[model samples]
Target chain A: MLGGQFLETAIWGLPIVIYPFLSGLMAGAFVIDSLAHLFGFKQFEPVAKLAATSSFAMVLIAALAPLVDSLQPAKAPLELYFRDHFPYSPLSVFIIIWTLYVILMFFEMYFDYRVENIEKSKLSGIRGSIARFLTFGNNNISKESLLKDRKALFIISAIGVPLAFAFHGYIGFVFGAIKARALWTSSVMMLMFITSAIVSGAALVTLLYVIGYSYYSKKNVVNIETLNALGIFMIFAIAFDLFLDFIDKLYSFRAYTEADVFHGWTLVYNAGGVLFFNYFVVQILLGLIIPLILLIFKPVRTSKLMMVIISIFVQVGVFAMRFNTVIGGQLLPKISQGTIIPEFPWLGFDGILSSIGLICLSIVIFFILGWLFGWEDSNKNGFENQTNSVDN
Target chain B: MSYRSDFSLKEADEDCNQELLSANFMSWLVKSIALGLGGLFALSILNSSDSADATEKNNSNLPTGPINNHRWMGWENPVLDDKDGWNDWDKLLNPKNLPVWYDNFHEIGKTKPKHHWVMVIDTRKCVGCQACVIACKSENNVPLGVFRTVVQVMETGSMESSPNGMVVTDDGNYEPNVKKFMLPRLCNHCDEPPCVEACPVKATFKRQDGIVLVDYEKCIGCGTCIEACPYNMRFFNPVTKTADKCTLCVHRIDAGLEPACVTSCVGRARIFGDLNDPKSEVSRLISQYPTARLKMSQGTEPQVFYIDLNGNLEGNTSMDKVFMEYTYTIGFNTTAYKKLGGEVDLPKIEEHKNPFKEFEK
Candidate 1:
């Protein structure tokens, strides 16, 4: 029951929110890909190819979210080519970082699939023709060439670990650098973003691995050991993310000036009813805390059904986290106190449809890559088997 | 019979030749006419620029005053008719006709007089009529639901008595006893503008004279500059598709005219001039009055200063009843203001309430 008051918030809408979330997922998936190749984690080896292909698919679709969200979609290229003169802007740096990461990941995927593509090229029809074109006429499938491909992938994955961190960490810096918004301006924002990205990435790849394994092998080849390891990794990442959230709350209570106290309260307590629930209940309880507790149990970690359910919850929770961070930060008026702007429209170009469209588009890309790479035919003699045999 | 047939055939052939020649002649004539017309059209187009210049010259020569019935009506100069016509006519009729402020402007670039432009607003004189806001909107062509300037109204302290002697709240639930004051707000044109720093393309930059401007072409409509501004002064202009804010009326200021908001202010509350010049009105007022800039703790060094500022200017009011009034739709809400009703309850004041009084002992 407030009196005549107007609330002004950020002009950015759902597309901008989805852009960061999708990019975070992409970065997270790539980090998981690096876990097997670069870190030589045996538990992740079985899913490494799956993770790499998923990450590549994610990267291919990452730019669409922001480009579609831009008011002038045609002029978006100017962000890199024409107007990227300012070195101080996090966004300018982001363009360069995102481009480099995409190239590295793309090349890594290409080399990983090169031998298989040459084999597929020897067959007849359009798929073979496409495979032949993809092979770029490098028909030499000698052990030495295959070894070189592995070495190249190892090198790229090594560089990609930091690149993944930078790609997603810079997105956090974009929001954190805004000194105007009280909720967004914090040094811990980048760490929070990166940690949660890992949590979400682990959850998504685990879910994809289970689905792909069941579909391709026609058996419940859900690797219990891999799922257990991923469950553990997710727990740690979620713990760190929650710890940052705790520290942010504590800092608000202790150090905020009198003028900023209301903003701090809005983030924790007085955020409108829906947003409050979204932040506290959905993000913290369901997304972080519940999953953490569930993953701690050996039975839940080993159980395929249980792990899949927890991963789904963790992803939902991560999405809620992003939603709250982005949309919640913009609810309160910058100058006025005790008033909140209503949520943005859920329909239209900037709303629910566009977000759903982007996700659907990403799925389409994932399936297309799956078909092209013969993901379903896991029995096929390919790099994954070769790499597994070498590791053994 | 054979000779007669040959003669008739020759005659028929001659008739056919005549018809073909006439047809060819007609087509040639049509082509020649079309070619001549196209050439004339091209020639006219090429000479149009010269004609345009001549027309501009003709416009300048036209009488400055309205035409009268007599041919020589506007030809006579009023200054020339005076006694000192010989000495003053040339000066008075000069096309430049510079305003008095131009002398001060010319002096600025010549010696580099440490020019730091500043604005001083006397809150005591503001009546909340919003002339300044309207003037700025028209001057800048600000779109609806966005403002280059705004007037913030903060009401506090109940009045002792109603001026009309009949006190009634709109809802008739309580007495109308609110003491309200309007605070005019615009871009402070801070020395360290966060918006300028946040621009990825350097589209928005602060000029040497302290006015910040946006290069619309380079902006790319990122809206990051709008996000970085603490005061919420910058907004996306749908017309230009770029972030825009108050330029301090730089166009007018360059020609030695006061900002439109300053000129249009009904209360004469706003004063604008170079802060470096001690003789400037803004400088004198700053020295004479106790003034404060908004959000000084942020260290932006805002150029817009306020005098007699009161009632939670820093937005640190502890009163539970005070709520901000925004007269336009913001975010997703289309309602003009959130539920406006009931008399504003004023906080009670304690007599002899100074916390520092005990410390003095």
Candidate 2:
């Protein structure tokens, strides 16, 4: 088995396979919160709020991702957070950490909301009592309480930073342990997951902010400075990702491990090959590189619209990388001692039912949660007021 | 009595406090000492077991010996040796270090056989007889659609011939000659095996005798090992969920007899032996004739050598077709197949039209 690489096993099926993605998203959210609140980067204040909202959405999705594998989604909790399963895998460890993080994030969000509602609400009796219990009976909007809450937020955000990275980085480690498949056997896969996480997180923030500011207000509060800074960050992240990709590909080529390079070459040059150069150039260069270059330029980067569009490309580019990495590694054949050839389904094999449906459900849940928590609305309301005041 | 009755509430509270304080201290001290001893005892047991278990597993079953010696040790029994000093190879071989080439073995008499057992499969000599196949099936009780040895017939030239029984060529009717040959395929039982490496659970392990075997109960049914065998010899037995391949009749071989397939071959094409023994039949044949192995470039170093191997090194063999069928599940992607030298060209079928679309319009 080509030096016994186990990377392919980590990505064999869908629901179990989505562990890396869920863990990565959570890690990215925590990183953002850490940057804004814990590290005290005032310019990164928007990211703190954004991270919390995304964290909440991602935690909710992760809580349900396991249910996709179970016959009964509701009953999954009994086997997971409640009772012990026979064998403990890396996935089991991830589930435990993810559950703890989700609970903590939920409570933190609840506490924040309760404070806000304590100021807004005039309800009495049980509703009031429940609200008081959540806020610890303090409805005071005093400077001291706000400062204390911020400190607590900072402490949790700091703790969350590494927990987030561990969530996804471990998935790569799992794949690397598989020595059977040559394509998935390298240490570089872990780094690839991490870099991709950064790109996705940055793009997500850029998209959300641009949409919130543009639709809600006649004037955009997000100036050229903020948008340009984000674009520069994204460009560099994408560049680093490409650099890592080059290293990984070159290493595989040099090692001749499991015929990965040979198989990759044939797919590139063969007449009837499914993987065309056009698809490669579009997905890798035009979608990822060109946008990165455009973002690097101050003139283009300064435009909020340009930044948002590039962010979308960055996100798409990262997904293309993931697809190629997962699908490309598996398409080679193993011959005991002869030349091997590989063939793949032209349309690409459809992901398992749970994997696709769970991912879709996660997206829906994210948007719905975003709506409920006023994540988009707060920015929208803030932007509109600023613009109206400027006009007056 | 009058003085005792006159005791104030403060005095009574003090008496109760003194009694309760002594009991609380005693309970706390006793519990603390008991917990400390229990923790220390548990820690020692855990520490000892962890180290001891690890040592026991690692002390054996690791690659630390010459393959033949390891095989010998696996089969040896000190108590049952004869006066002549013939070791207990009979007891040792079966369920021990019997090579993958072993299919079965049995004893005929008490007299020691003059020659150590060996078989040689001349690909040039094989005539695709189904007799050997049937014999092997009955002898080994092999499962349906599964065989210990399969005959792969490859035709090098076109079927059509010129008049007077001459092979036709596009250039001169002489360049491309019609050539057909039969290669009876079985596990090579490689010295360095890819299948063993591919098994995550160590279910498919290599014996010291250079035979690879699958522990069916231990196998996770991942089918990864099946994909790793370049010869495409191993197959997943759906019944057991473990990778199954030819075991060269280890039972028969251990009993000082030939494998079922080798014994049954009508053409006398199969051979089995220990290459290590200088006087063995396999060694004699190797010295006497030029020998080759199927797909030697796979780096497995197969123990089963062929006399005068006729097939092309890069030719499309029957094994390639089987490999293509199970590629997806095993993570043996399309890329690896092309790289290992398989024909990229296949007959392209035109896309079918959607009748529903036409009907709807």
Candidate 3:
């Protein structure tokens, strides 16, 4: 046959990559929060409030990722819900599930902080006024009311566990459901997304807890037990994530169809240089394997500085995993036999700037929430000691 | 720290006053902006709905006579009368010569055509002229860097000989000679289109007549449909800010006119008609030839069929030799080519010296 060239451009870019990464963080953080409240894990008690609020903040920002990624952000709601409603679409289902998850997180956080909100409402200034408003005019801080709030919080957190999994799992299904793209169509894609989300989420919250407690609090308090527990969780999640990656690769290799072969070659042979290096070096070796090996040793897991450093690597590696999944899938032409498309430009509306800007904005929002809620003051013993002394 | 009794109520009141003022101002600003944007969107939607209602009402009131008036097309025209019609109206409406699908008029008791549109590409007649591609671009105003229809050329076989010997003289050996074929691809308008299922907003959908169309106004340009399509036929139209693909020229089809690509095929390679009608050209060709659809294993049940699809020309298996040659344009870079780990440069096209004529016995 005569040789003719066909050129196809990458349609989805950085925004798509960032959106899934953000959503994964939201799901992962919320699951960690649930581990304390529902399962009664005493080791996670110190960071329980931090994780809950962080989860709430992450969802708020994560919701905006897809909207900003849209070419028509303003019209998205009208188009999605009214004009072009497809209830069966995974994306539409994701939106519904994500909204419910956010609401559940909000209620859980609100009830957990209700008693504190009543006390803060007595203080002078805008902080007090905001706290008062948040309490919904019911200043009842009675013991019975607090017990009811605890029950509600426990129930919501329990519900939130699976909802968080579903939220991130559906995000995976968004790509996995596309039967045409061999790389994304695996049954393991959803499991892979969930596991990686846990790794990234745990890493992020660990970093935040260490930084927030050390810098923001008056006493510069550091909960060694809590940090160590989070480190252990991150290690296990990363190991599971790596295991899933192995299973996915094994399945693809065994299937060995033309499309599967092409997908495998693309990743292994550096068909797209960025994807190959990103997967092997950054994601696998540095992100998953190194972190796993480091966390297994008691010295590294117990050392606060070492744990922080390892978590940072885990975070970067998990993000790289998301990048490899989202962008790598689009790199190849849908035709199994076709060549890969060019890399998307890093500048402009759909580029890396949008991704970084959104992430920075989310971080800023989280810090602002942390300050407003006085999350830095949330020490388990510190709160109990102060209240007991006051009663005496 | 002392309990709430430490601060005076007057001090708290002063602090509350300042905070309330700022909070009220921020709330007001947000409300006003939201209201302003909401009004504008509502107005636009209302105006569009009003216009659509008017068009429907006008169409229902159209006159039934002068069925052969070309100016009326499928759209109604009350001004047209039998007195102003051409003499060949009876000849044009004759079912024996023309299929029932050809009639666009809505007579009082006339039934709608039981038609399912399809296309048949006779690869044997194609000469890689790319006339259909140009015609489709012109008709659809498809932007550069993306295509609604493309004529891809596939060449196979290697130009190297075995290590231990001279070049083999086998007919199947492509070392000294290569065989090429042209494939004109467009939207398959599949019976079970994945794009429709993948569209979160349902912006892309299949019509009752089997044409896949994108609702530009409703599309948010999330690009999910573009990823869902196995053919890579869909593209993000920057101008429209929506996902776009070949609509099979529904505008012309509705008017009983052939698609621009079908009309402009220089080699008479493309045949378009109602596949449901056994006597239609496309249906007849399907029956006569052992036609094949691209990626049939995908189960998309594509409507477009190809005649005489040669071996090694199936699917995108032959894209290794295919090179996309075009002038560099902004927003039109081929990421797929770069991802394939190839040097991103346009190679010189080799002129064929009528090798078939030279090799003839």
Candidate 4:
């Protein structure tokens, strides 16, 4: 690679990529959950428990990516917190927003699982005793109290959705705010991130909803209408996301805007480069377009198998977009004329292995929470059979 | 009962589907508008973060040293003049307005500084020597693969009409007719240093004397400062796990001696002095002759000025010339100094936790 003098060797590697991918899924899933609780979309209610629980899990894992990425992982967050920080710095603001969002997620899950906890408290053994403890002494499962819980859920969803947006949007701002990097200086970065978050999050929730419902009920049949609704959201979200990327890239060209100082547009546009493959081929073509096409057809949208495949592609695209932003932006030297190729981080604390570990950890946590609280059983007995009553 | 999963979109009445569609449309309409508005609000704040009117500069949020009056370091700045330009409807096309490039002397601090530091380099007089670069390394104890200051050997004109002709190396990719000049670069210690603004943890800050230093204990080793510098002066210190850069030899300057680089310049190409004191050599040289600074378009307000530059610094990024991707950097400087019969053992300086603590008698 012909790079200029002193290309930055401390390139932020794959951990930063996983950070946004997970956070987007976190936010996007919560937004989908909001359609039912906040907006009274009854058809979406069956998937609500699955979406919210998965969102909670994503947040837990997403939080780890940055901590692992920080230079002094142990010391860095303390300084960012417990010490003075500039409001202009997005990282400073994100910590506060993230904490609030985490608290919000916990409350949302509590209200979501409250009735099940009340019911489980009646059974014998340690599980019953644990459920009794989680009920917080208010064992009432009356309609009024449940309606009150519904109102509370609505409020939590309202705040949760934007807080989720803030969490993911702040990540975008961390890159976009840097005026020197031509590739990331796009004003539309936050919009692109939010839109893509919706796309990926919806896709993941759809996939999880289909898969989780089937696994929990020990049946292949699930709610087709709810799956179609998620699919519709996925299609629109992906379309809007693609439009944002188009605008971001189109204006980033030197011909369109003055901010493309080092020809960041050219690097991504260059057919010969890795960034071009990440941005154009994997991110735009496979990740977004393919998923959008797959989700658009009615048969595909309703088919549980097809939904899972499209969601995976959507995730791939979102991850590639993040890879393009964080890694691609660092390829060119700030002071020199040439480009620097980053060594792939296959090993290390924040390497690809740790990322895979983090994902597996989140999945483990998700199931443990599911087993302890019976999130699957609640969905199955409560809303599951009723929603599944409709023919596919 | 309403919260229970009794209602499905099986559309009860014939009109129910239409009502549901309108309600969903309205829900999306409100959300889309909210998202759009939130984005605009964010864009407005971020673009205006560095605006001039952040007077009293309370928002900078640096923990140590009072960085008050240094916000734009007084109104000789192009960026400050356009502070209100963000509100103008015509200027809405660009909220992140670009700053016009210009140069002027910034008095070091609000209260008169006991000593105002400044540097003026005579690029014409520089003999492409490695003296200053070697002295700085040994004095600062800059680790391997990095340097505090460097003399960038750059070229002008085409590969043809070459001065040295094609190198004796047969396969070398050499540009012909390219006239080479060496430009020495270190920390500019800008009046409104961008690194200070970029740090999230308030690790890097500019002192009253205009010497920018990193609080090593405070630094998170984020590498944002290294990118913020236009001069490429900052580097990640592998030893300390902190960001390292030229402090303009703040330690030596405090001891009433010249910087190591200044003392070692065989050609006396680098000049350093108190610019506030009009009788100083730096002040005299700047007033006497026309001088230019590198990358003024960046609006960092770099204090280092160059004389007889004569198109040496234009039409290129930092360090213009590249012969086999080689610059007379730290390793090469150490080798050249040894060839010139310079000694190896230079004293190692301890890292200062707080270099800019108020001067005590």
Candidate 5:
């Protein structure tokens, strides 16, 4: 989809600047999981699961997103993939990692899901025979196999974390590189993208799981302990993201050229008054702060329903944050100096709206697949089918 | 025994068709929609190109001229069609193309300096006539409405009088007496440019002689360098679908001729030379005089510079002024039109001077 968008821009002169955000979201999801899992944030387990699965699904969608907007959709990848000059091309790097990350996530999920069937088959003679057949007739669920899976997950996630950062960070770096425009120019942008990715990922997974549990089990299995812990993490990530943006704008506002000031104001305000206040205040205060307060409050943190509402708000906030960073960053006009004046129609609708719709649709598909694959399976029964001894 | 059999049977059912079914449906739906949307997007792009061509034909009825009057080509023609000397709604979106002869005629270096060509725009001589902007566009086949260079006017002092009998400013704004001057700015083409460093794929790069250029083909339209530049010079060319900025007329400079802006300076205020050569006019001016670059402290190291920038016309001062009030003192001087054949008594310098310097500290 991303390739198509690029192709469209190259061919049709599409005015939309939202293509990078969609791709950033894809890689950003996995990056969030790597942070939670590696740091051993058990409260982030729900977030981790959501990030892993959403990123997994988005990888497939983002790969095609650019193509949807390109003139020669088929030939777009050839620009980077062709062996003539493949090495060091950023697109080539992204394509290679995108493929690797998706495959790694797929195998990780497969290995994880197979364990459940192995345990179920152990209960009966006939059913055990069937479970044995289903799991390639293997019956090992010992400490050795568990240890191997744990190690594999750790290694992959370790490597995947940086790759995920590189993936989303590359997008920020791309925009920041343009010195012709004062609005998009900043060294801190890539780091901002990476940090925000964590924010979005943490919020997304927590919200999805709570909803998933409520939808399927009807008993609110998303524990308050998990929600409270994840909510706290969300606040930290969000605050950091906001701070970086403030520093960038404040520094520019002091000495901005007329064009820079114009662009800067557009970035901060847009046609709709103060761009951040509308999206960010709601995203931060209502989405992050309220939930954070709830989690900190003794009464709300213990309630499953309250926790569920807070998680939903957090996830929504994260999405809005991405929208603001990606879209708001580009809203500023180029070449502002002195008393910066706002200009443009610099942004447009076509690509942004289409991408949002497509991403939502892809997410819906991800949930349906999760439902069928039994995403709710507990670890106790899922590990028995491993042929090798389990450890860890 | 029965429970084990049932569990195995369920596992078998899931593995056989249930798992593949969900995955396949998702893959199919996503892939198909993606393909369809992708195709539509491509078709629309192709259609836009065709539409532009058609609009070009219809643009003959339009007013064809330069748009923002800046040196260098813009992405679109300056014309918007009119009916009976009024606005023509149909021609607003339809753009016209440059003359065929304008394409590829002057490849630069053919008639001008081969490399390291530079220009010094003397603000003292500039009358804000905008001749350089017009001359550059016509000479370089630049498109209308977009400027590769801009002449900004800085006005300082206030129009109001203070309570004292003296002609001091009462209103705080920089409008008194209107001591205005024009600063024509273009690509600095810095030696260590921030734009080049910010580009992820090296789409925009600095030449050996310090001219920064963009390769339209290689650019993915990511707009990274636009954000990197503290100077807002780069513009997104919607037609070419790439980021563009001034290249200091490298092509013209390479042709062994002066840049359009330099040659077009009617008052001879603009000077072009090779700073590396000690004999060069620019080198002579820089070594012998007080010259200043735009935003020197930012460390981009811009090649462009100015001379005789008055005391009130220093660096950016808006932020400092908000925190404190500044005091300005006026002084008088006489510049004789003829060469002074004899020494004349000069007025004593006033010790109680302007207080602008305190803000910098």
Candidate 6:
């Protein structure tokens, strides 16, 4: 609550929070995709293709969220193109990693959809023509070529796992490395960010899988085992995330705000505080606790409908975590004991409305990618199986 | 039988509605109490923690791991990296090392600085005139609200209104218990600036002679630097749409003139001069006085040394109206803004249905 020389308007606002959450979702989805290809988790097989597609869509949207947050969005390209962009700056590191990662994801998706693209090229329709153009005419559908595609995707996922971690870790470091901020200075910030990212990513995949499968399948009954595995993965992620929270909270006890107030106790956990609700209720209780409790019961985890609801709660929880870390960190000024109000502009480019628009844009991209890639055909995905035989 | 059935159905609807309402109220009560208990528990913990001893001083045990790793990271400033990149701050604090401090600064080919700039603020002499504040605005075209430099009045509770029937005068010290005084505040232009490193684009850079400034063209206004600055010196300029901060009046310094704020300082409290020349007034005063810096433990190593400045600046105060009138807002104080020669016209206030409109004549 250091009310010193505080800004009238919050500079980071909702966009900053949304940017990190979206990117985290991207990274988390990448992690799930990799779990099947890289880590040999057969349970994650069902969601791998969906995860990759979602990851690609999210990366684009997450990247744009920052541009919206920047005052001079036009100059954002200069971050990469500008000569002597400071190499060590977290933001600079993020841009380079993000670019490389996006390209790698594109390649992975290209390979995933390559076989399908070739199959469609034989048909007589606009989608087939479009598929032919998308394939770039190297459409060798021989058994060896399918193996080669699988090998390529395998290597890409391997490389992408660390890159994905680095990409998301950079966002955490961007705030965590700031020596001036009391709340953001903890050593565990990056780890916490990564874990929470996995939680949100896993949850979103679970939600989409449940909903998407029902939409695509004639029978309402879906893969209960996959949903259970996702729920288990989420529980572990949330538990790890909560443990980090515990450590950070205890460490903050030692830290002091610039205003001579307790940094952790006053701003973070104080009951009447705005940060309190964001941290405890939205983030911990409804987001993590209740969801965790529901998922622990065998009855809830086995049910697709219940898993969907839990996934929603997890996304909301992770979102609150980001909101708390970004906006809540800036609310308390460094000068003295008081807070600046975070007046969320519901309109304007930098407002909450714009963030909602960006999210919608991401969903639209997901739908477009699904249509373009012919993902409605269940046999088209599943990287390992697709390489085994050609679908005629 | 039909009449009895209708009556029973109506009774069931009423019972169901009442049950739902009670359930809603009960859930709300349970949730509120749960959250409230967490807050109360937190408050009690805070109280217990506050009663701890002297180690609870501000910035004690401050975390500075990333800042301390410049040498390890091998990311030292290329120009000064080999021999003079890092300085032992404790060594520089000694007056005997003043010449050494000036020697290594800014040695680029044929462009080495002759004078190392430092500004010393004497808090005892500040009268809270608001002249420096106004002069800075007029000189820099600073917008209606924010200040590049402003004087803050720290009221020490020891001050008495009319103690011992002694009358307070312009030049007289009437009350011995009085501690009310003005402490002029501005950017310290820190040696180990956190803002410079945090800036993603390196838009903010520290000059050879200790002046840290922002390159407006490169700044994307990510506000990373704004958060990095512990002193709250950096701001977003609405006109430029980039990050802005106090530049130590480098333009005027190059022009062989004092800063607008320094030139207009009536009390002569602010003395800016070269640390290169030991005979300079700034060097002499700094050597003589037991000077102190704010939040020194944060390790920014602030360049502005304050004399007779007690570190008890009480805060959590509301923003003053003048400070509240930032340019990014829909409207601002026209009367106050005109003083600074603001050009923007007043925006039309969106009419609202007044709650007391019914009583209007």
Top-DockQ candidate index: 3
The total of clashing pairs for model 4 equals 9
**Clashes per prediction?**
0, 55, 16, 9, 96, 5
Please provide, for model 5 over A1-392, each residue's C-alpha lDDT reduced to its tens digit, 9 standing for 90 to 100. Answer: 11111000111112223344445556656765665556655554544555666777666676665555442344456544542122333444566666776778776565544566577655555554444445554446667666665666677788777777777776565455444444556677778777766666665566566677667654235556666666566667767776776765565554644544454554464444446575657665775667665666657755666666776676566566555554555444222212221122223323555656667767776875464333553532222322223321
lDDT at position A283, candidate 3: 86
Best to worst by DockQ, what's the order?
3, 6, 1, 4, 5, 2
Model 4: residues with Cα > 4 Å off, grouped in runs: A1-7, A123-126, A216-221, A259-262, A372-374, A377-392, B1-108, B161-175, B310-325, B328-361
Q: Write the per-residue lDDT of candidate 1 for residues A237-314, one digit (tens) a residue.
A: 889989988976666664553445455455344455437787788888999999988889999988888888998998
| Candidate 6: clashing pairs of residues | A1-A337, A1-A338, A2-A336, A3-A336, A271-B39
Q: Model 3: per-residue lDDT, tens digit, B1-361? A: 3555556766678557646755775688799999999999999899778767755644676664324332233122322222322212223222222222111122211434356788999998998888888898777666444568878765555465544434556534334345676778889988778888787886666654667777665678787787788888887764455677888887677668999999999989999999878889998899999998988877788989999986555555544554333223111334444444646555444433332334345
* A239 Cα displacement, candidate 5 (Å): 7.5
Candidate 5 second chain TM: 0.55
Interface C-alpha RMSD per candidate, 1 decimal: 14.0, 13.0, 7.5, 11.2, 17.0, 15.1
DockQ for the candidates, in order: 0.14, 0.05, 0.26, 0.11, 0.06, 0.14
Query: Per-residue error at B184 for model 6, in Å?
Result: 1.6
**Any residue pairs clashing in model 1, and if so which?**
none
Q: What is the lDDT of residue B135 in candidate 2?
A: 71
> Residue by residue across B1-361, what tens digits does model 2's lDDT show?
6677667766677546544544555677799999999998999899778757755654667754323222222222211211211222334444443332211112211223333333467777788775666776666545444455666555544444445445555543433354666666677776667666554444555554555666543444444455466566676542332456776776666576778888777777876787668877788888899887765655666777788775453322323232222221222323444554644443233322331334344
TM-score of chain A by itself in each prediction: 0.91, 0.76, 0.91, 0.92, 0.73, 0.91
- Tens digits of per-residue lDDT, candidate 4, B1-361, equal 6644335434245236334544665677799999999998999798677554453343456442223232122212212223332213124312233221111224344456666698999988888787888899888766555678888665566554334566545554554666667778888888867777777787776666677777665677666666566566787765555678887987677668899999999888899999889999999999999999877777778889999874636423433343322443632222223444545443344434333334422
Docking class of 3: acceptable
Stronger candidate by TM-score (1 vs 6)? 1
DockQ of 2: 0.05
Best by TM-score: 3
Over A1-392, each residue of candidate 6 has an lDDT whose tens digit, in order, gives 11111333356767888899999999999998898778867667778888999999899888888888888787777654573345656787888898899889879888888877877766666776667666765667787787788688889999999999998988999988877666777678899889999999999899888888888755223567777888898889888888888777666554433432254357455686658887888988988889888888888998988998899999999998999898877766655334545666678767779988888999998889888874432453433454346432
| Model 2, runs deviating above 4 Å | A1-26, A52-159, A212-226, A252-260, A268-273, A302-304, A336-355, A368-392, B1-361
> Candidate 4 has which clashing residue pairs, if any?
A3-A338, B154-B321, B159-B175, B159-B176, B159-B177, B160-B176, B160-B177, B161-B177, B162-B177
